[model samples]
Target chain A: MTTSIHTLDTPVAVVDVARMNRNIQRMQQRADSLGVRLRPHVKTTKCAQVVEAQIQAGAQGVTVSTLKEAQAFFTQGVTDILYAVAMAPNKLAHALDLRRAGCALIIVTDSVAGARAIVEFGRAHDERFEVFIEIDSDHHRSGVRSDDPLLGDIAKMIHEGGAVLKGVMTHAGESYKLNTLEALQEIAELERSECVKAAEAIRAAGIPCPEVSVGSTPTALSAVHLEGVTELRAGVYVFFDLVMHNVGVCALDDLALSVLTTVIGHQPDKGWIITDSGWMAMSRDRGTQAQQCDFGYGLVCDSNGTLIDGLLLRSANQEHGVASFEEGMSVDVEKLYPIGTQLRVLPNHACATGAQYPAYEALQPNGEMAHWSRVNGW
Target chain B: MTTSIHTLDTPVAVVDVARMNRNIQRMQQRADSLGVRLRPHVKTTKCAQVVEAQIQAGAQGVTVSTLKEAQAFFTQGVTDILYAVAMAPNKLAHALDLRRAGCALIIVTDSVAGARAIVEFGRAHDERFEVFIEIDSDHHRSGVRSDDPLLGDIAKMIHEGGAVLKGVMTHAGESYKLNTLEALQEIAELERSECVKAAEAIRAAGIPCPEVSVGSTPTALSAVHLEGVTELRAGVYVFFDLVMHNVGVCALDDLALSVLTTVIGHQPDKGWIITDSGWMAMSRDRGTQAQQCDFGYGLVCDSNGTLIDGLLLRSANQEHGVASFEEGMSVDVEKLYPIGTQLRVLPNHACATGAQYPAYEALQPNGEMAHWSRVNGW
Candidate 1:
């Protein structure tokens, strides 16, 4: 009773169920052995089913980029969630609603104004909230520097304003810029040490800090030590994209999701084969920019899911993709993919491509199909 | 009354009504005097409100890239639609549903299997579908070359089947690759002439050839003459992006939509200001590959929607963006944007970024906000 292309709609997302389970279990086992609580980020899939899988595989908490995700998952019985993004004043009500719904909501902030806004919102709603002062570990993206004087001030404000200080959190976002695993490991250590130091600073300021969170898909997965970190929040591990593979975080086989498309035309003279999948199908995520290897939009695969070596989607439009094989790479396009023949395309960034589609067609080990819905919007 | 940030949720999308209406009228008026049918592609906005505005502005029909989009717009009273992508077997039933609901669908196909599949589906469903044989114009993406010997044969097969032949169509997708407007105009003329030749071949083979549709936002806008193109199907003109401006299609001021975000933190030493807008908010669309100028992720704007000269979002993580100004291009990060201050970011690709959020907060000329939902998923 294997489900084939005839049973599903074109342009629908499909996840290899066995591979997905493996990805979840592998990360959970690593986190468990490292003595750190695993809080797998749900922003990758935005699907309750995927989140449930992670929870069943031993994720103690879930990380979300938006308050909408927190509210949606809270309604679905996921009580512990880390709203990983800086909360805006507009989203305060939604956060309060999640807190009222018995959610162990954790919010991150680095600015004095952000701290004040959250504090004011908590007072107005008369709700006690958990807060973490974000530390900038690598000067890559957001957060106050680990040694910034403002860190202690923000911690004091959060403590005095009736909010529970939940230690500190930081992301080694620059870890993705590393070209070698050694560089990534160095970044991981730096992130852990900085977070511990930031927590120590808050403790010295008379704030009771309980948990220190650190995350980055590359750094978290490859970190050899978790001496100070109490929790790990890494998304994109469950669905490894081209960017992850290029950074040596995961292998090609570890990627659990892909966009299934069909060959629509061919230009043999120009050595171009057209597929129905375009940027809209795979997303405009050029995660290969920093990678050692550039896999155009994504790694092309044959109908049976075998990686088509040297073939890449060289160009794309809104609804059409042009694939070109590397020089001297030869394959019988007409025989392997007669017009209308179906094939799968691995994404450059799973989170972006996966978000473009509405639902996932879960393919079991034996090829049976089970549909799962994904959440979108704010 | 003006809409307050407190009334809207974080991560929700917003559209400027005045700018959008102006964009609609400008394109409509341009196409009207050109004596070509203005068939606005709905893929850019995908909002019913935006589609209604296009229709009210004298757009004769709508263009969509997927069967799901076709069904959505059809249900919304858009009776005429051109499903711009190659129609696959999986989408045939959905296309038939739209036709059964009394919607006129113009689908595109270039191969024999595609033609056969559509014909078979039409016969099985006891319905007739209108189709256009897609022709390659500049080897940009999909479609058979106009000079391909099989072009006439594919047209004959469709004409012999129960489906109605609606001439041929082509898109100069490569027009975006041009470095100058002269190149764009050349590509446009090439696309229009190629499509006309393909339609002529179909008519010579005794098929009814009524319309030769050619489109590409860059080409359509800069084209001096569209003599052979009976109908134009450009979409991105409604919301010009950095890609459009780079390709000489539209100016930066012509971009009608932007991602609204709030400043969260700053690193004074590094001159880095972080915002809530990241790849998730602006989309990971690097439209600068073909453009002469690279705007990093997108053009930065101030709280009042004014473009911040010399400042661009140099880097982004999944949930955080860091803006960098050119050397010596001084700007007040603290005075202009205190923490929690709102700002807007123009996108690199309008269609890709617009698809990230689920709805648009339609802002009236007076700054009053109204909710307009956009359809997503397959």
Candidate 2:
């Protein structure tokens, strides 16, 4: 049966295949121009098809937030996988299993304790693991400061423990907060200079620091250059969200993922259109709340992906989304969007929202929808 | 091999089986004393094991927020299912299919448009689906007002269309905002009073409205009496959380669900012990942000589930959680919680946090962990 967005079940994740392809090509081309290998983060989609597309578009490898992603992608034939999150000592056995299974899995760490654990585990397993020294470019999350003297100590531990200090990496996650082009450009520059500086210092200590990787969706797209950086890692770019749009990286039309919902009822006096795509489908990620343009849950669009005038999901419960006018327009909401009307809501975050769905209904340009399984959880 | 919390992977969901049983028993007893049937909303845990415990503890049936929940639970041998969300017309076919499959699935609706669609579908399919009219008790979310004329009109449509107008149901969701016992009790009464009023109006309009359902975790626990209410539905009570704690219903110790995470690294100077449980695991609920006490992400507890004084998950990224002191104490983070230390974090909202995990590691009283699969998606 031919299925349009309206024909699909409510609260289903829909991916615009054409827009996704365009996003992939844009990111890949930018990486190519900057003379760096794009190891696209698979955390956003966590789908085999999306990662496959990225690799086909010239991505050198895959960056994963969880070991599950690395295992899932590696099992799907993508050998070079970087486990980007700071490794816990307890997870060493699992990481070793993946490495021993012939997956080129690169583990990252910032603290001396973290490095020692990785080194100790590598020695115990009789395996030489490639380790990346995490750098704090934005101080937004975990990482060692680029110029911190402890970097030498950590580098020495990795090397002495029979492991390779492969490189230095940092994610300019705070770049999502920047709306102005100048601010984004500055953050991008800082991301590059700091990460490269971290790598140079590690090499100066006589430790071989081969790669310097840096990226976040905003920083990667906004960075005019990627000097001295060997690899770039950016997720969410494959499916730009309202957060990215508010950050001035992508336009509303560039959003490739949305939650397909059906209007069940309405609050006539309140001008509200109640939808099945609540926080469970749209996610509780209010990533756009603090941005220049706050999309309450998401920006409402017709089933065809056309932006509906002034409508937005004002609030959400577990399984009910209250869509109303952004400006509190007193127009009859039920008359405008009657019961059973299918609407596609552009989520505030592709990563958070996409995590809520079991699979994505990838809509092709030919008006066909394909189910792409998206792996979730740790 | 037998599993304990210590042996499990980091960032896993854990359910304290003992505490859950206690919670289930308490709610079932409350319903018994109040002269109502306890229909536990399986939407909270979405685990057959958890639902089984509730049923074993004397729950009448199951209340679900999604049709998928009805279908899954029905397959699990739960015949009586109440799909509580306002039904969209397109979902009528799916609901009918489930009904024909020998599942006593009751669909709820509020508007005339919703009632008419259900009627037309019922007449066409030759299936008389049981319908519940949603009542707006506290004006929190979806429901027809108790005094509204449309309630009678919708009731007329359901009865005349050859479908049974089963009853009226309302969720005092706003009761979660109340910290005072008096406020909670009043809201509970209002929920019961308003729902009863709607039921009476329906009966007066020549329709037999047999059931009167009303509940919220807080209201269900605090209501002095559920007078004129035949049934109660509460989900999160099965696995209480910080939001429930702040509402004065469940104590902090009653939070059965917690995210089992391992400390991966530390930002010593900043007094931060980073864990693998971030927004992806803890979820971006922040439900406690406006509450009396804000437990950022969650309340941190030791591996044994003992509350760690002053420690809380301060902020979270996609894959990392920065656990710091609630009072911003300049304590030695590394010494307090070294790398690889497993901690169980009590979530702000149980429903939101539990949705992130694929399964729960149910902690038995004898200190063993059992893997309980949790179904997700609509």
Candidate 3:
């Protein structure tokens, strides 16, 4: 049931559906066993077809990074969505629209100004929107300090404004920067504790808090205990990338998505094999900058999905990818992959690479191909 | 004439139409003065509107990174399109589709297999496709060596395959690696010499060679002489990015496209300003990896398009951008930019960043906004 190249176009993003289902089931099982709800983040695929698979795998709700995603998924019949980013006033109308459309919309905010903006917007619209106060767990990225006076003030303001203060949410985003799984687990525990503390502060301030959310692919996958986290929101787990593998979050084999390309030329003298898939196809996501190993842009795979022994897309231009084999690794670039030979490249960041193309050519376990379009932009 | 936020969404890509028009005119003037055909590469924007603008500014033909781009522009009445990439068999049909639809299509190949594949596809389909033998210049990314023995053999084969061997093409992509304009000029000269030599070899082998092409934004913009280049193909000049500025191809003021985002929150004590524009909005293109100065992700701008002093997006998550103001350069984040305040962010690589979104919100010089969609995928 393998689709012929003639029917499909080159440099189109293709996802192995069988592999993706397996990946989703595995993550769902892990969350179920841990007594935690898995809220699969839709930011990775931005495809309704993929989100349907996640929902089928027992995902409690979905997390989105943009209002456009919430609007798209809400239209597609998936109502519960957590807009994982801080809600801005300009985007309030879109959020309110989703809320009015029967979506259990949850928006995150960290500052007093943010809380006020949401309150003002919610008041004007006469909408009671669910709100999550973002807590700074490791001081890695954006968040309100867990014990900061601002956190209590924001929670109190949200409660007074008639909006439901769901609880606190924090992401151990810097867990990806850890060198070991132990470090990731430690970061996870810290994130959980910080979130719990933020929730407790809001409660102590006479505000009702329902859930404490904490997430990061590395931390969630490695965390020993989900002490306070009622829901986990991790996106990259569905299509593990090189950065995930480098951080000990997943193995290279766990990567379900790949960029299928064709070798178009070669510089035998320089040991470079040129491919039609360049940065435009594979994406410019060099996720190895903070990792232990740099596999150039990505791991090169044969047409059959087997990792090539030494080949690497070391450099790329707009429309040209240059493959460099390891110093003495034996791989016949000239014969093994002729000019028309098809190959797949596992990307450094699946989400970034996936977003570059418009649609995905889904491949089933039986090798059947189905075209699925991905939604983009806000 | 200013359009309200409700008219166009925040965190949307905006291209200053007036600046882009000026950029097109300037580049066309440079090419006209140099007495060379300007085949402006459409890879930067991938928008037919931008391509139409380029053509209107005197671009004789256009260069495309993918067959999909060629198809889109051709459908928009752009007849002459150079598929400025090594042509693979998988994409031959789509390239032929463009040709059959009355497009003056030209593709490039460097390997015997590439030449033979294009020839075989042409023969099987009974179609003719123009081709240029891609020559490896200073950039070792792709293409056959200028003096490879297979060069002459491949050229002869392409000429006899019912397809015209236009000549040769080379790109000094490494010109972006230069630190000074003088170095870029040297790389430009080297690129021109390589293309000329490849064409000379094909001519010496008794093949009809009519065109020699060479291009790279840095090379095309800095080259003082164009001795052998019949056509110049350069992208990224229309919307200069951080990479272009670092490479001395353009200045900071030359950047025409930017992501318009809203400041959603602030971590005042930490000097962190959070914006709705994250990697998903700004793209994960850190093109300054090779440059001495790392502007984090990109330069930050006020709502009025003025570059913020010493403030840069220091870190980014999937949907969150964290800006850090250099020590001693402090501005009240909340005061200057409240929760609803709009800001613009100049991207690292315009092409990669621009591709994340579906369309451009074209901003006129006087601040009016119009929408234009960009084509994606192959």
Candidate 4:
């Protein structure tokens, strides 16, 4: 844990420790002031060390994207966990195992058929599976419409089928596409209200709905207030990336994650300084492509983590990234960025880029480093 | 190895063993009939088992995109390794260790500065390292132009620096952009002839040019003859993807890898069948976006490996994928693909998609599975 950051290998994922702590504190304060518990989504890092820090910073429970994550965190002694993604019937046994092992794991469903499968599996196993209904707040991705008659119907089905009907949840993923503050705030309000409305319907139908959750990094940061929401869940806010920067949620300096790379070669005439951080290192997520500013692959930075204006990682092959300036081949690249020079690239999306590496080199404020392992796959 | 593939976890990567071996033999026969050695690029799979199979099928040596691959394969007794990407000066120590361990690790360079660094390091270590001068035949990526005056300059520098000058190499990455057989064949010839021309220039300057290596999956498959070339190196052909299919080189059935997933839920009105194979499992590789036919994230298929006529994985979140018809949501998704139903999705790019999984489930001909571990990161 005491290795120097600069001594690490190129293409290593580095997390700025100071920035990460600040991000965690900012979100925890926001949730506390809004009177909602922050159930930070552990899917962002999937590292026990990072989640431990979140829990220490006042996160009540954890939100997971898969059963594997729930199992992983539960092994780390985290009891309360919510698997955010809609449950697949085939994964029922894995969920049951975690619950039986003393982990309060909650699964979700968005359709009547999905609920039926869960109920059938729960009854067959003679286990009371806690379930949540997913609501469509912005019509961005998979979720049931808040007003759908099936929302209450699925709740009643779960209650009558010997399973625990927990609550309703939704993610305002479409809020990412909006640039204006007003639009983001409106979507945030919608995400909170719709999820609350879904919970109310279930309770009115004589079903016990104990929780109502809503989040997305953008919506969580822009929400005016969570009047009826009981808990907030947001991933990627702990390590804000270029996508969040473009959305006006975080400043460029607030980006905690970057890929440390080495300048290998250069195409002088073409003004390209090829680095070892390519798509494999930075990931193939072009999240900033549709924003007001499009960082081709990512924004380029100096070895000291200072943003280099005009210079950008324009294109990438599997193991090579081409760094070029917007003004064209104006400088002597070989002279300016000689071979072996170290550089860091700010990624477009933190979650995608972090998944590319097995372990993260967390650069502490004292210049020391901690190697934190990251889990991958389902 | 005797376990049935159907019993494996959902979202696991499955490599059809029969199809992979057929791909290996097809490429090997092509290279042998053309009077060239086949040096399979292990970067495609990064699996020792897959590379061993290639060598068993007559591949002479291995091509790698990173020193990590060289180290991994070398530890497995594969001494002949080519670190194909332009070597970064900082990796000199690691390369030296590989060489000292009796590995014939060949490094590459495209510029005078890059050559100088290699020479300086070689002399410092008192080792006559073998070096390859990369030639830019297609102007697509890193290399000194085939006709650039620097070709002879770097070659002379490498030869005089107490190092072994191995000769020239190039990758026709632009070949993937072509769709017609004629265009692909023409680019393949150009890739070969231009690389040969670069080697001729080095030799014309009184330097020995023993090898002329050129390849890319599309170029290697389309080249009519490699008259002046000694070796061909191609990755991704062992597991053809939608990108290669759109490039008109591989048939749909030629694809050897797929993500096996289960239908989790559905939005009956939107006709969306949600699956656990999201970007995390399928990878965020939209490589076919600009191709002749765009397959969103991937093409949908039945559990038995037959292509679904109109179904396509239209979009992906972190832990979920939305499958719908290309024309429109015309079918009752809940009935057609009920919850817990198994499905397969062919990826857009084999290399990117394969990088997402921790291990690949090799599906043998008899429907049994062999879990093959895949190497990741530098």
What's the DockQ for every one of the candidates? Answer: 0.66, 0.86, 0.80, 0.83
- Please state what fraction of the native interface contacts candidate 3 reproduces: 0.89
Tens digits of per-residue lDDT, candidate 1, A19-40, equal 8999898889889988999999
Which candidate would rank higher by TM-score, 1 or 3?
A: 3
Q: How far out, in Å, is residue A127 in model 2?
A: 0.2
Report lDDT per candidate. 0.83, 0.91, 0.84, 0.91
Cα misplacement distance, residue B45 of candidate 4 (Å)? 0.6
TM-score of chain A of 1: 0.97
lDDT, candidate 3, at A296: 81
In model 4, where do residues sit more than 4 Å from their true spots?
none
**Candidate 4 chain B — worst ten consecutive residues by lDDT sum?**
B326-335
- Model 4: residue A313 alpha-carbon error in angstroms: 0.4
Q: Which stretches of candidate 3 lie over 4 Å from their true place?
A: A1-7, B1-7
lDDT of 3: 0.84
Model 3 lDDT per residue over B1-378, tens place: 567533567788989777788788888888888789999988999997889889888898898887778888888988888988888777777788878889999988887778888888899989877898888898557777788888898898898877789888888877888878778888889998888988888888899888988888888888899987798988899998998888876778889998888888887777788888888888888888679778888889886678988988887777778887998986787777677777788889999888888888888767677778888777
TM-scores for candidates 1 onward, in order: 0.95, 0.99, 0.97, 0.99
Candidate 3 chain B lDDT trough over 10 residues, lowest sum: B1-10
DockQ top scorer: 2
Residue lDDT tens for model 2, B1-378: 268678888799999999999999999999999989999899999999998899998998999988888988999999999999999998898999999999999999999999999999999989998999999988788999999999989999999988999999999888988899998889988998999999988888778999998888898998898878899999999999999899888888888999999998888877888999999999999999999998889999999999999999989998899999956466887987889999999999999999998898999988887889887887
The TM-score of chain B in candidate 2 is: 0.98
Residue pairs whose backbone atoms clash in candidate 1: none
